[model samples]
Target: MMAALRRRDFLFGSSLLLASPFFMRAARAASPRIISLDYGLAQTLIEFGTPPVGLIDTPGWYDWVMEPPLPPGIANVGSNYEINMEMLQLLQPDLIISTPYLEWIRPQLETIAPVKSFPIHAVGSSPYPHIIAATLELGQIVGQPQQAQALIDRTERDLLAAKAATRRLAEQKLAIMTFMDARNIRVYGPGGIFQDVLDRLELQNAWTRRTNEWGFSDAGLADLIGIGDSRIFYMDPVPADVLAGLAGSPLWQAMPFVQKGHAQRMASVLMFGALPSVSRFARLLAEVKV
Candidate 1:
């Protein structure tokens, strides 16, 4: 009886080994080579443990979204507006990720590879949920669903912690703006990622004016005078000469927030990026001495 049982087990094990190659092929098929057409998609892909085969605008990516540094040897596909089609064809990516902003070129991208467009900044929708959903979808594409869930859970916890830490500032109005030039600044308004993050922290956004579909309005320094007695956090990457010029300008110095010492410069964050960028901004804002 024992000899018969051993023979049966040996045959079963051998059959399993013979079928392993088929399973391996299926697993490989699921994880397609991915290329991102923009920084947001590239950042999401990297966060999902599926670093893209190539991406556009590496230098701009480094300057704007600095965290989760790109791995060595990531090919530069081209600029965001003008992708190098010849180089992209050589890379032979199985999938290309993009946003609705480039819908006009979707047909062109489809010719090169299967294009998957995610509308992250949709009207009447919160970007936070969109980001979470995108991360999960990308994880499934890369066959790392478990890792994706772990990241989402961690981000929620971190955001909540930041919210708790900044509870004291919740009652205070905060204005976030980006310097465009000496005379103009782009201020974040309701329906934008920064405003969404501020709302998550239970904070009030001081900029109540209307903004474009992207959630920012281009306004002069005089426009900010209305956010009286509020904390103003301007993003970085401002030219040194611009700073010097602002310092010397009496109009800038006369702003209500500046006069009250509530205006300051914050670290540069990709205001439109996903979890990592949001988490970075939240934690930094909470840590700032206001």
Candidate 2:
């Protein structure tokens, strides 16, 4: 009887050892395979060194939100308009990170996994606070609260360094815009993420015109002329056609800032981004002397 009992226990122990890998994978799957549908959140997660299992529009994300690069093998679920729900389901994710922009598809996504919606540019609330709060919240959710705080602290340090470097030019009124074409421009104004960064650095915004809740005004060259010699900084990745058209346009040449040689071009920076992006913009501004 004693010999039989010993053999049974040994067999049970061997079985457990053989089954451990599968059990471990199941536990890991239970620990939330987060899928970020938003670029800002993806960037945030990457900055924290926790790349999501899935995200939307990986190619566009690479183009627009360049920094804090995504890790290899991240699954691209689909576009913002239509998520590849079939692919998402195949991943068997435990969580789906999203924002209000995906409200239309939230219900469907929730059906796959517990959807965690973060209002990035929520109504009536500034994005700065939301960015920090969201970062912390995400850290807690992902079991990396320390990393999130460290990233925020590091970003703050970098911003302060950039601010000190640009102290002499802090008071310079600046106009930052991105061109959709030769005629149309989206100018960043008050209540925008850029404005919040400028405010933190004690910089003044040149475009005082009222903007939409998203904190930008879509207007023509006529609207931009009012900027009146403030250092004009345009974000890059300008369409080749737009650049060519602007080169020959009489009105563009006649603009006061253009005539005064105040216009300058900076590399692509995401207008709606998180902490790392804001830090990047600050560094870019400091590096590019107006």
Candidate 3:
């Protein structure tokens, strides 16, 4: 009777061990090495503490995402739109995360492993909700749901704090731009994440022109006169030639923001990234001198 009781207890203990959280985590750690084809998704994966084994264009990460630098050992699998298939097979990833725009290459990626496409951009709506939903889904996929929630919570708090700290700029009527060339700039406005951040911060976006799906419009230097007394915050890494040309152009020097010293350049930040990008933008705004 004692021997039978001990055997029964042993079996129960074994079953509990198999179903334990540590066991589940170990099982996950051993399988499903992930590769991300989208930078935004890669950012999400890393933020949730489950970095992908590989991603696209690792070199450009410094110039764009800048914050949360890419961890070493992540393979650079070449271009985002078209990845190196042979290299991908060499990595032997169990899962590949991409965006809806890359559906064209899904069949190719599926040949190596299961491919999952997530979207943070919608044509006619703010992308903040979509970004949140994508982060949650990706966290669930990587078995880090709790970590993902923590990141979301932290981001919300940081953004709220940034908003309160930046209330002084509400009446400043800011125009965010990036130099496209000597005479042209891309002004950010409605339908873009920057605009969404501005809305959350209770600030105004001076660009009201028609924007593409990504939420920026191409305009000439003189066209900015329409914004009327708005401060211009341009992104950094402006091309050397564009700077030289602007310096020489009478029209560029004549801009109200330039003459008033309201045109300032900010550190590089990814305009197309996920939640981290939103938080980073807010933090940058809080640091704004205006």
Candidate 4:
């Protein structure tokens, strides 16, 4: 009976030698450390509230993904195809995630750590099922199955909400494009994530021209002139010089959508992203005044 010894009497030898909150947070960030090579895959991890320990091009994550802000203490492993080997070794990730697009280098990643490719777009089919499968699988990997289901449910709910919000917009023909300079544009069509979102929202995609499995075809302003009166939604952050060039091009000013005031500039949304991008595209379209 030490009479409940006075506080701080045994501070150095106390039974509670637990870690501080800051140290706990630091441990959380690195434990089960996962590295993502694809931004879309990274988006799923971020959604589950367990961002990767490292990823390709962390600096550009905000520039493209734009929401679900990236968490702190993640390392940048350099470009998608050109990962920094020394940095990769330093991070000591437990798992490295990639996509079919990076198949050529999966073996290289494997040399560093176990590499899991959440292949979604390789089969040249609808990305909806693949995204669902990937999300569920990744959820299991990160030990967040319940959160995964919640994410799926929320995405569907938000998509339906966007559908309701864009009831009138559904009646219009819409085409999404990203400029490859002022000369070439990648207009998205069938067989891609953007088209899947368009289909889900009960909207029409104006560019019926053939698209690669990734879902866009490189074309010029002259090619777009054929899709008369279709609402144009171009992804922004277009190179400044290219934007200036387009401004002066007579052809750009002459497109049917441009002449009819139907062209809209949308913030940069990853046309190739999975569920997260699907929801983002839906919201953007729903919010458009036109």
**lDDT by candidate, in order shown:** 0.77, 0.78, 0.79, 0.79
| Stretches of candidate 3 exceeding 4 Å from the true structure | 1-31
Judged by lDDT relative to the true structure, which candidate is superior, 2 or 4?
4
**Candidate 3: tens digits of C-alpha lDDT, residues 165-250:** 99888978999988888778889888778998999999998788888877788888889988877888889778889877776888
lDDT tens readout by residue for model 2, 1-290: 65454334333422332343322332343234678898888888888777889999888865687788779989999999889999999988766888887889888987887677888773444688888988987776555667889989988998899898887666568899998887899998776788888888898899988887787889997788888877888887888898888779888888888998888988877777888789889899889765
Q: Give lDDT for model 1.
A: 0.77
lDDT (10s digit) by residue, model 1, range 1-290: 65454334333322332343322332345355778887876776787767888988887776788766887778898886798898888987767888888899888887877777777775554677788888777666566667778878877887899998898777679999988888889999766678878888889999989887777888998999899979999888776777889878898899888888998888888877877787778888789885
Q: Model 2 misses residue 187 by how many Å? A: 0.6
Give the higher-lDDT candidate: 1 or 2.
Answer: 2
Model 2: lowest-lDDT 10 consecutive positions: 14-23
| Residue 88 error, candidate 3, Å | 0.7
Clashes of each: 0, 0, 0, 0
TM-score for candidate 1? 0.87
For candidate 4, what is the TM-score?
Answer: 0.88
State the local distance difference test value for candidate 3. Answer: 0.79
Q: TM-scores of the models, in the given order?
A: 0.87, 0.88, 0.88, 0.88
* Clash count, predicted structure 3: 0
